[model samples]
Target: MFPGSETRAGRLLVRARRQGVLLSRAFGGPEPGEALFARAPKPWMRLLPHFLALAASASLLPTTVVVLLGDYGLPGVLAGLLGVGQAAPLLLAGARPLSAWYVVFSTDVLTALALLLWGGPLDGAAWPWPAPTIVGYLLLCLPLSLHLARRTLVAVWLSTAAAAVLVGLLRPGHSPGSSVLLVVLSGVVLLLGGALRERSEAQRRLAEQETISEAERSHRRLLEERARIARELHDVVAHHMSVISVQADSAPYRVQGVPEAARAEFTSIADTARQSLAEMRRLLGVLRSEGTEAEGGGAGPELAPQPGLGELGTLVESAVRAGVAARLTVTGEPAGLPRAVTLNAYRIVQEALANVVRHAPGAEAAVTVALSADGSALRVEVVNGPPATPARPLEWHGTGHGLIGMRERTRLLGGTLDTGPTAEGGFRVAAVLPRNEPAPGENA
Candidate 1:
């Protein structure tokens, strides 16, 4: 036992000093590190002792058989066969569960039967043949627990006692007193060894469970750290990006002699940047939280005066300002659309316009925000014509996370997206979102 591992129950079994010495040796001394093959079963170690017993029996059983049965070569051959029989169950078990216990039980029964037939210790005919029982008991002691092991120990003792009595009856001249004493002592040793092995097995299981629990806790902590970092980055960095965009839009308009077209182009550029920054921040915030906004609060900061279908023209104007020639068109009355639906519709257009600026710069684009004929849903679509030049800008880089982010947001709002290239050399992002009835205290 290590310094802190000693238990009150274990200490009570034997003398403190003697038990301490034995435990220290078994655990590999005070400074012992983990074993080289700690987790693997030592099958060879158990098999070695059984092999020795088989060799001893080869000589001992045959010599005794010659005396008891009076056959020269025949007695030796029979004795050798019986000796080999003892090892059969041990080899058959081969890493199977509870194999140690099965081997011990088989050995005990065989020993009792052999001793009964041999008459007594006085006959010396096959006295050494039962020696393998001790080896079997030691092998079993490795993996069985003390609580259940006691029952097996008792079984071995009863079998040994019965064999001793039968041998005394069979051999009339043998001293029954000494023979019985030896048999009782052997039973006691088997019990002690098994009890020690059982205690070790229980301790090993407890240690394994603790290790598993510690690993799980470590993994959970890592996920929490990532979420915290995401939330902080969204709150701080995304806010500054929005500020830069708003300032950029005002710059061109304030300058003198700037053409109306040039001023509109700069304003559009500012709108696209602000929109992209907002969407990214919301996405980062969503990733940081445990659940999505549809399950509770909105993605991030709530717009002071939220945009609805009425703002579709302004969105188109901003895209035009950014260098894309955008035209807005409406098909039906868009009144009474739910706030959630309106917000998602705005975001869909926003992301589409941002993709145009980033992926198809200086392209011609069109915006359409329409209410369904049944007035149950709102449909928003942004279509951008192909880029002007054959190759895109050198500064533009796409991480590929944007499309997935957009689709996730739409799904959360109970919407579906149909996005792909158009027949007229353009890309389109079309989404249809539901308008749920407002709950109490919610704006309609």
Candidate 2:
């Protein structure tokens, strides 16, 4: 023999040993991962298993006793004991099918052996599997088919067929048709039960996939809203930078009798401002290109000016016209603040009132604007009471991103926002923004 052939044969032997161990484990009692019969969803369907078990027990117990006593002439005590053993297992088959099957099968084999050994003259009686035993076995197989793994099911069916064949060999004179009938009917029940289990599993997986898809779409919308805010801020800063560059370049010409040294200083300021502007435009170009791609290639940034605190009165008026008793109040002297702060503040109020119109129909709303005592921060609050009447159903539902947009705006300005329900069953939204831009690295 070649040297390599010995090594190959040894590897094959190890593989075969592993497979044999797995097969043996499959034929044993139920493992930890095996599926079991689940409770039915509907309230009425849940009682079906109990009803079937009761009906089967009532009918099979008496029939088995009659057959054994009249046909086989067995003693009353032995016949009653065997009848109870075969019929009792059906009650527990839904929860522990494999253990129940073991009990039922053992009783069947013992009864057949008892009839073969001590019985009346068997002149045309069914020897091995009588009608009651076959019915009980088939009933147990219903739950087994729904719960057992494929490997375990195959092992069980094969073992049952093998046992039937051996018993038929022992009694050649009795009818052989009972064994054939039991095997064929049990096979059909298993096939139908397996198909139903597969269909239920497929529906469960489809529902899970739909939930995951909805979450992904919501996350994508949040990212797009943030990008839109960034683009608008970029335009505001660019406009201010352009004015500074033009003023510096023409400074010397505006003032008469200027020194050369000071003129050279103005030129240097203009050069630095122009360089910064160029870099900012390049970055803005990349943002716009990406936005265009996302929007199918035809979208552009809005050219109209962004709104500020001056526009709050118009927003409140529109809400008032739409059935809400809305009021706007100013508590402190208005101070000149950064454009970004004012823009975000206006948007926060706008969204708050819109929510009132949509959710709290016919409710009273109050909008308050105040400046801090030290004049370093601005506070804006909007509160609305509970609805006075039932809200009418509208065909269009919102995208559910209003709160997310408000939170994002506050974070960008390094400010804090608080929102919650009020004591009188109303909602309140409050925000505090710095009057000036935050110091470098302060937010970090």
Candidate 3:
């Protein structure tokens, strides 16, 4: 032999031994806490195994006992013992299939030996594996194949075949055909059961994957909505910051006899506003990059200037053109409000009216804008009567993005939004947006 041949053989032997150990573990009996049946999704399905067990036990137990006594002419005690042994496994199989199989297989081997030893009438009846035993074992294999690993199932089949062969050899001429029949039938049943089990597992995995994918999609959509809101608000806020910077820088020149301290304060305000604008631009750039990536490497459509309270009239007019009976009412004097407040208020009204148009076709919608008594806040309410036409089918639902956008807008501006069905079988959306922007670290 070569110098390294012994070492190579030793390595091969070690590898083979490790594989053998893994196979043994794979084919081992059921682990503690292993379930014989998977949890059924429906409540009614959970009772199916119990029903099957009860039916099989009631029928098979007596039939197996009668067959053993009549055909094999075994003593009544031995026949009854074997009968109960076979039938008991059916009841046990639902909770512990491998254990039940062990019981049934052992009884089968013992029965074969009993037939061999006790000289019974040599009628042309199926020996060793009687009909009832065959049926019960086949039923047991259903759960076994469903629950056990493929390697364990293979091991079980091999063991059954080995036992059958051994029994046939012991009783040389006494019905070898019965053994072959049992083995073939069991193999076919186990194969079908295994196929069904595999398909069920695959479907379960697919459902779980789909659920996970949906959650991820929802999360991504939420992030995209937030980014879109930020981008819109950026335009409003950046404009204000630019105006502040301009006014602060021009304050001393525009006003007469400005004090030195006042000029320094104006200079400080201008510098702060410019710095804020620079920061906002950077944030906007990041948002745009994310938006481009989200849109598959292309920029979104060009956005129009952000809308405000003034556009509410046009919005209502558009809704009116879209088959909605819509009217706009402004209460109290319209005052100059914070740009963020006005923009969010417009969006809320727009979304609310759009919802009415889509969900309540041919419905009359009233858009009411009320300025608070002290001009501290503005209340925007959109209420629609019941649809004159039949509503859309439940399946034709929106993606909820409109509501999310409205809520986000209101929340950022430290507002209160209430939405629900009214007594008149219509939906009402009411938002109260504060005139001032939310302070930093304020909760909406």
Leading candidate by TM-score: 3
CA-lDDT, candidates in order: 0.52, 0.70, 0.72
Q: Show pairs that collide, candidate 1.
A: 145-198, 264-321, 265-321, 268-321, 268-322, 269-322
Error of 1 at 179 (Å): 8.7
User: Measured by C-alpha RMSD in angstroms, how accurate is candidate 2?
Assistant: 15.0
Candidate 2 residue lDDT tens string, 43-71: 44446666787788789999999998898
The 10-residue segment of model 1 with minimum total lDDT is 1-10
lDDT of 1 by residue, 1-444 (tens): 001111222234224434443443343211112221233335564354446444544544444344433422234454455444444444322233145445445544554455555434434433423444444443333322222346755775676577566655665674565445546565666666555655555555454555455445444544554454355445434645666686677777567788888888778888888888878876776675554334345444332345656686788788778876777666665665555566557666766666666666545434333435236666776666665554453224433334544565567667788777677677767777766654333332
Best by lDDT: 3
Query: Can you give the TM-score per candidate against the true fold?
Result: 0.37, 0.64, 0.78
Tens-digit lDDT track of model 3 for 239-290? 7788889989999999999999999999999999999999998887777743
| Superposed Cα deviation of residue 161, candidate 2 (Å) | 7.6
Instruction: Give the candidate order by descending lDDT.
Output: 3, 2, 1
